[model samples]
Target: MTHTLVQDEAAIRALFTSLVEGMRERSPARVVARYADDAVTFTLAPPLLNAGLDARDPEAVAGWMAGFDGPITIEHRDLSVAVSGDLAFVHGLRRLAAVPVGYPEGFSMWTRITVGLARRDGQWLITHEHQSVPFYMDGSFLAATDLEP
Candidate 1:
Protein backbone atom coordinates (compact mmCIF):
# COMPACT_ATOMS: atom_id res chain seq x y z
CA MET A 1 0.00 0.00 0.00
CA THR A 2 1.15 3.55 -0.74
CA HIS A 3 1.04 6.62 1.47
CA THR A 4 -2.12 7.80 -0.26
CA LEU A 5 -3.78 4.49 0.48
CA VAL A 6 -2.84 4.81 4.12
CA GLN A 7 -4.32 8.27 4.26
CA ASP A 8 -7.50 7.12 2.59
CA GLU A 9 -7.84 4.26 5.02
CA ALA A 10 -7.38 6.59 7.96
CA ALA A 11 -9.97 8.98 6.62
CA ILE A 12 -12.51 6.22 6.07
CA ARG A 13 -11.91 4.86 9.52
CA ALA A 14 -12.44 8.31 10.94
CA LEU A 15 -15.75 8.50 9.11
CA PHE A 16 -16.91 5.24 10.71
CA THR A 17 -15.75 6.43 14.10
CA SER A 18 -17.81 9.53 13.66
CA LEU A 19 -20.80 7.41 12.75
CA VAL A 20 -20.44 5.36 15.92
CA GLU A 21 -20.14 8.53 17.94
CA GLY A 22 -23.26 9.91 16.37
CA MET A 23 -25.21 6.80 17.26
CA ARG A 24 -23.97 6.95 20.80
CA GLU A 25 -25.20 10.50 20.97
CA ARG A 26 -28.63 9.23 19.85
CA SER A 27 -29.04 12.06 17.43
CA PRO A 28 -30.53 11.05 14.09
CA ALA A 29 -29.67 14.37 12.51
CA ARG A 30 -26.06 14.00 13.51
CA VAL A 31 -25.91 10.53 12.01
CA VAL A 32 -27.74 11.57 8.86
CA ALA A 33 -25.36 14.45 8.35
CA ARG A 34 -22.60 11.95 7.73
CA TYR A 35 -24.39 10.72 4.62
CA ALA A 36 -24.28 12.33 1.23
CA ASP A 37 -27.33 14.03 -0.21
CA ASP A 38 -27.92 11.08 -2.48
CA ALA A 39 -27.11 8.51 0.10
CA VAL A 40 -28.87 5.17 -0.12
CA THR A 41 -29.25 2.74 2.74
CA PHE A 42 -30.42 -0.85 3.09
CA THR A 43 -30.77 -1.38 6.79
CA LEU A 44 -32.58 -3.69 9.20
CA ALA A 45 -35.72 -1.67 8.69
CA PRO A 46 -38.76 -2.27 6.58
CA PRO A 47 -39.44 -0.98 3.06
CA LEU A 48 -36.18 -2.79 2.35
CA LEU A 49 -34.39 0.24 0.84
CA ASN A 50 -34.13 3.97 1.34
CA ALA A 51 -32.81 6.52 -1.11
CA GLY A 52 -31.75 10.11 -0.71
CA LEU A 53 -31.82 11.30 2.87
CA ASP A 54 -32.98 14.68 1.69
CA ALA A 55 -35.89 13.14 -0.14
CA ARG A 56 -37.24 11.54 3.01
CA ASP A 57 -38.71 13.34 5.96
CA PRO A 58 -36.24 14.01 8.73
CA GLU A 59 -38.73 12.56 11.16
CA ALA A 60 -38.44 9.23 9.40
CA VAL A 61 -34.87 8.91 10.48
CA ALA A 62 -35.60 10.38 13.87
CA GLY A 63 -38.33 7.85 14.46
CA TRP A 64 -35.89 5.03 13.91
CA MET A 65 -33.38 6.56 16.28
CA ALA A 66 -36.07 7.11 18.87
CA GLY A 67 -36.70 3.36 18.95
CA PHE A 68 -33.49 2.97 20.88
CA ASP A 69 -32.98 4.50 24.28
CA GLY A 70 -29.96 4.80 26.52
CA PRO A 71 -26.43 4.55 25.22
CA ILE A 72 -25.89 2.67 21.96
CA THR A 73 -22.67 0.69 21.79
CA ILE A 74 -21.31 -0.66 18.52
CA GLU A 75 -18.30 -2.83 17.87
CA HIS A 76 -16.80 -3.35 14.44
CA ARG A 77 -14.50 -6.25 13.60
CA ASP A 78 -12.82 -7.74 10.56
CA LEU A 79 -12.84 -4.32 8.99
CA SER A 80 -11.43 -3.88 5.51
CA VAL A 81 -11.23 -0.56 3.69
CA ALA A 82 -10.33 0.15 0.09
CA VAL A 83 -9.91 3.45 -1.68
CA SER A 84 -9.33 4.53 -5.23
CA GLY A 85 -9.23 8.26 -5.81
CA ASP A 86 -12.54 9.75 -4.70
CA LEU A 87 -14.28 6.43 -4.19
CA ALA A 88 -13.92 4.21 -1.16
CA PHE A 89 -15.66 1.31 0.53
CA VAL A 90 -15.45 -0.44 3.86
CA HIS A 91 -16.95 -3.75 5.02
CA GLY A 92 -16.97 -5.44 8.39
CA LEU A 93 -19.00 -7.16 11.06
CA ARG A 94 -20.79 -4.89 13.51
CA ARG A 95 -22.22 -5.77 16.88
CA LEU A 96 -24.74 -3.35 18.37
CA ALA A 97 -26.22 -3.40 21.85
CA ALA A 98 -28.75 -1.04 23.33
CA VAL A 99 -31.71 -1.03 25.66
CA PRO A 100 -34.93 0.82 25.16
CA VAL A 101 -35.37 3.35 27.92
CA GLY A 102 -39.10 2.93 28.46
CA TYR A 103 -39.45 -0.63 27.26
CA PRO A 104 -37.93 -4.01 28.01
CA GLU A 105 -34.30 -4.70 27.26
CA GLY A 106 -33.50 -5.37 23.65
CA PHE A 107 -31.39 -8.10 22.13
CA SER A 108 -27.85 -7.56 20.93
CA MET A 109 -26.80 -8.99 17.60
CA TRP A 110 -24.03 -8.85 15.06
CA THR A 111 -24.62 -7.92 11.44
CA ARG A 112 -22.57 -7.49 8.32
CA ILE A 113 -21.96 -3.89 7.34
CA THR A 114 -20.73 -2.37 4.12
CA VAL A 115 -20.55 1.32 3.42
CA GLY A 116 -19.59 3.08 0.23
CA LEU A 117 -18.20 6.58 0.47
CA ALA A 118 -17.31 9.35 -1.93
CA ARG A 119 -15.00 12.26 -1.38
CA ARG A 120 -17.03 15.30 -2.27
CA ASP A 121 -15.40 18.70 -2.01
CA GLY A 122 -12.61 17.24 0.13
CA GLN A 123 -14.98 15.64 2.63
CA TRP A 124 -15.83 11.99 2.82
CA LEU A 125 -19.57 11.24 2.86
CA ILE A 126 -21.33 7.94 2.89
CA THR A 127 -22.97 7.35 -0.48
CA HIS A 128 -24.38 3.91 0.16
CA GLU A 129 -24.74 1.56 3.08
CA HIS A 130 -25.98 -1.99 3.62
CA GLN A 131 -26.48 -3.95 6.81
CA SER A 132 -27.58 -7.56 6.73
CA VAL A 133 -27.94 -10.68 8.79
CA PRO A 134 -27.53 -14.03 7.09
CA PHE A 135 -30.34 -16.51 7.52
CA TYR A 136 -30.58 -20.30 7.62
CA MET A 137 -31.67 -21.92 4.39
CA ASP A 138 -33.40 -24.82 6.11
CA GLY A 139 -37.14 -25.15 6.45
CA SER A 140 -37.08 -22.59 9.20
CA PHE A 141 -35.73 -19.13 8.44
CA LEU A 142 -33.58 -17.90 11.27
CA ALA A 143 -31.03 -15.10 11.50
CA ALA A 144 -27.46 -16.24 12.01
CA THR A 145 -26.60 -13.40 14.31
CA ASP A 146 -25.18 -15.79 16.84
CA LEU A 147 -22.10 -16.35 14.74
CA GLU A 148 -18.96 -14.41 15.67
CA PRO A 149 -16.15 -13.23 13.53
Candidate 2:
Protein backbone atom coordinates (compact mmCIF):
# COMPACT_ATOMS: atom_id res chain seq x y z
CA MET A 1 0.00 0.00 0.00
CA THR A 2 2.81 2.38 0.81
CA HIS A 3 4.50 1.68 -2.47
CA THR A 4 1.30 2.18 -4.37
CA LEU A 5 0.64 5.48 -2.65
CA VAL A 6 4.09 6.76 -3.51
CA GLN A 7 3.66 5.78 -7.13
CA ASP A 8 0.27 7.40 -7.30
CA GLU A 9 1.62 10.65 -5.91
CA ALA A 10 4.44 10.61 -8.42
CA ALA A 11 2.03 10.06 -11.30
CA ILE A 12 -0.16 12.91 -10.12
CA ARG A 13 2.87 15.16 -9.89
CA ALA A 14 3.79 14.25 -13.45
CA LEU A 15 0.33 15.36 -14.62
CA PHE A 16 0.90 18.85 -13.24
CA THR A 17 4.26 18.95 -14.97
CA SER A 18 2.59 17.97 -18.22
CA LEU A 19 0.05 20.77 -17.79
CA VAL A 20 2.82 23.34 -17.38
CA GLU A 21 4.61 22.05 -20.44
CA GLY A 22 1.45 22.02 -22.52
CA MET A 23 0.66 25.63 -21.65
CA ARG A 24 4.19 26.75 -22.28
CA GLU A 25 4.22 24.99 -25.63
CA ARG A 26 0.86 26.43 -26.66
CA SER A 27 -0.64 23.01 -27.24
CA PRO A 28 -4.23 22.79 -26.05
CA ALA A 29 -4.43 19.13 -26.89
CA ARG A 30 -1.48 18.45 -24.66
CA VAL A 31 -3.05 20.33 -21.77
CA VAL A 32 -6.45 18.70 -22.09
CA ALA A 33 -4.89 15.28 -22.27
CA ARG A 34 -4.48 15.38 -18.51
CA TYR A 35 -8.23 15.40 -18.08
CA ALA A 36 -10.80 12.65 -18.40
CA ASP A 37 -13.34 12.51 -21.20
CA ASP A 38 -16.02 13.76 -18.81
CA ALA A 39 -14.01 16.28 -16.92
CA VAL A 40 -15.63 19.53 -15.73
CA THR A 41 -14.04 22.76 -14.65
CA PHE A 42 -14.87 25.92 -12.72
CA THR A 43 -12.17 27.98 -14.33
CA LEU A 44 -11.00 31.55 -14.02
CA ALA A 45 -13.18 32.27 -17.05
CA PRO A 46 -16.83 33.19 -17.19
CA PRO A 47 -20.10 31.21 -17.22
CA LEU A 48 -19.24 29.87 -13.78
CA LEU A 49 -18.47 26.36 -15.05
CA ASN A 50 -17.01 25.01 -18.25
CA ALA A 51 -17.99 21.78 -19.90
CA GLY A 52 -15.41 19.12 -20.55
CA LEU A 53 -16.44 18.92 -24.16
CA ASP A 54 -15.70 22.60 -24.53
CA ALA A 55 -12.31 22.16 -23.04
CA ARG A 56 -11.65 19.16 -25.27
CA ASP A 57 -12.24 21.23 -28.38
CA PRO A 58 -8.75 21.85 -29.62
CA GLU A 59 -9.73 24.80 -31.77
CA ALA A 60 -11.53 26.60 -28.98
CA VAL A 61 -8.91 25.84 -26.40
CA ALA A 62 -6.17 26.87 -28.77
CA GLY A 63 -7.91 30.12 -29.53
CA TRP A 64 -7.99 31.09 -25.87
CA MET A 65 -4.40 30.07 -25.36
CA ALA A 66 -3.39 32.07 -28.38
CA GLY A 67 -4.56 35.22 -26.60
CA PHE A 68 -1.25 35.15 -24.82
CA ASP A 69 1.48 37.15 -26.47
CA GLY A 70 3.89 34.32 -26.02
CA PRO A 71 4.29 31.17 -23.98
CA ILE A 72 2.18 30.93 -20.79
CA THR A 73 3.96 30.01 -17.61
CA ILE A 74 2.35 28.52 -14.51
CA GLU A 75 3.80 27.42 -11.23
CA HIS A 76 2.13 25.27 -8.60
CA ARG A 77 2.98 26.03 -5.01
CA ASP A 78 2.13 24.46 -1.65
CA LEU A 79 0.32 21.65 -3.41
CA SER A 80 -1.29 18.98 -1.30
CA VAL A 81 -2.47 15.63 -2.56
CA ALA A 82 -4.39 12.88 -0.85
CA VAL A 83 -5.09 9.47 -2.27
CA SER A 84 -7.53 6.75 -1.30
CA GLY A 85 -8.28 3.75 -3.45
CA ASP A 86 -8.89 5.07 -6.98
CA LEU A 87 -9.87 8.59 -5.95
CA ALA A 88 -7.66 11.55 -5.19
CA PHE A 89 -7.93 15.27 -4.51
CA VAL A 90 -5.41 18.06 -4.67
CA HIS A 91 -5.48 21.63 -3.43
CA GLY A 92 -2.88 24.22 -4.12
CA LEU A 93 -1.99 27.69 -5.29
CA ARG A 94 -1.22 28.22 -8.95
CA ARG A 95 0.49 31.30 -10.30
CA LEU A 96 -0.34 32.13 -13.88
CA ALA A 97 2.03 34.56 -15.56
CA ALA A 98 1.25 35.64 -19.07
CA VAL A 99 1.43 38.50 -21.51
CA PRO A 100 -1.88 38.83 -23.35
CA VAL A 101 -1.92 39.77 -27.00
CA GLY A 102 -3.12 43.33 -26.36
CA TYR A 103 -1.52 43.74 -22.97
CA PRO A 104 2.18 44.39 -23.43
CA GLU A 105 2.55 45.00 -19.72
CA GLY A 106 1.69 41.35 -19.04
CA PHE A 107 0.21 40.06 -15.79
CA SER A 108 0.51 37.38 -13.16
CA MET A 109 -1.97 36.19 -10.55
CA TRP A 110 -2.22 33.54 -7.89
CA THR A 111 -5.34 31.46 -7.76
CA ARG A 112 -6.50 28.80 -5.37
CA ILE A 113 -7.15 25.48 -7.03
CA THR A 114 -8.78 22.22 -6.12
CA VAL A 115 -8.75 19.19 -8.37
CA GLY A 116 -10.37 15.80 -8.16
CA LEU A 117 -9.00 12.83 -10.06
CA ALA A 118 -10.03 9.25 -10.60
CA ARG A 119 -8.05 6.27 -11.74
CA ARG A 120 -9.28 4.80 -14.99
CA ASP A 121 -7.56 2.01 -16.82
CA GLY A 122 -4.73 2.30 -14.33
CA GLN A 123 -4.11 5.93 -15.25
CA TRP A 124 -5.07 8.90 -13.14
CA LEU A 125 -7.07 11.59 -14.94
CA ILE A 126 -8.53 14.83 -13.71
CA THR A 127 -12.31 14.61 -13.38
CA HIS A 128 -13.07 17.96 -11.80
CA GLU A 129 -11.15 21.22 -11.42
CA HIS A 130 -12.09 24.38 -9.55
CA GLN A 131 -10.13 27.62 -9.41
CA SER A 132 -10.75 30.90 -7.65
CA VAL A 133 -9.20 34.07 -6.31
CA PRO A 134 -10.54 35.34 -3.02
CA PHE A 135 -12.63 38.47 -3.11
CA TYR A 136 -12.46 41.30 -0.64
CA MET A 137 -15.21 41.39 1.96
CA ASP A 138 -15.34 45.15 1.67
CA GLY A 139 -17.93 46.86 -0.47
CA SER A 140 -15.57 46.73 -3.41
CA PHE A 141 -15.71 42.91 -3.47
CA LEU A 142 -12.86 42.86 -5.94
CA ALA A 143 -10.71 39.84 -6.43
CA ALA A 144 -7.42 39.88 -4.60
CA THR A 145 -5.28 39.23 -7.63
CA ASP A 146 -2.40 41.21 -6.27
CA LEU A 147 -1.87 38.80 -3.42
CA GLU A 148 0.82 36.10 -3.47
CA PRO A 149 1.13 32.70 -1.84
Candidate 2 lDDT trough over 10 residues, lowest sum: 49-58
Question: lDDT of candidate 1?
Answer: 0.82
Question: lDDT of model 1 at residue 22?
Answer: 76
CA lDDT of every candidate: 0.82, 0.89
- Alpha carbon deviation, residue 72, candidate 2 (Å): 0.5
Instruction: Give the alpha carbon lDDT tens digit for every residue of 13-126 in model 2.
Output: 999999999989888888889889898898888768777687466787788888889769999999999999899999999999999898858899999999999999888999
Model 2 root mean square deviation, Cα atoms = 1.6
Q: For each candidate, what TM-score against the reference?
A: 0.88, 0.95
**Model 1 Cα lDDT, one tens digit per residue, 7-101:** 87888888788778877887677677778889888887777888985424467867777777877887788899989889998999999888866
After superposing candidate 1 on the true structure, give the runs of residues whose Cα lies further than 4 Å from its correct spot. 1-3, 54-58, 101-103
**Per-candidate RMSD, Å:** 2.7, 1.6
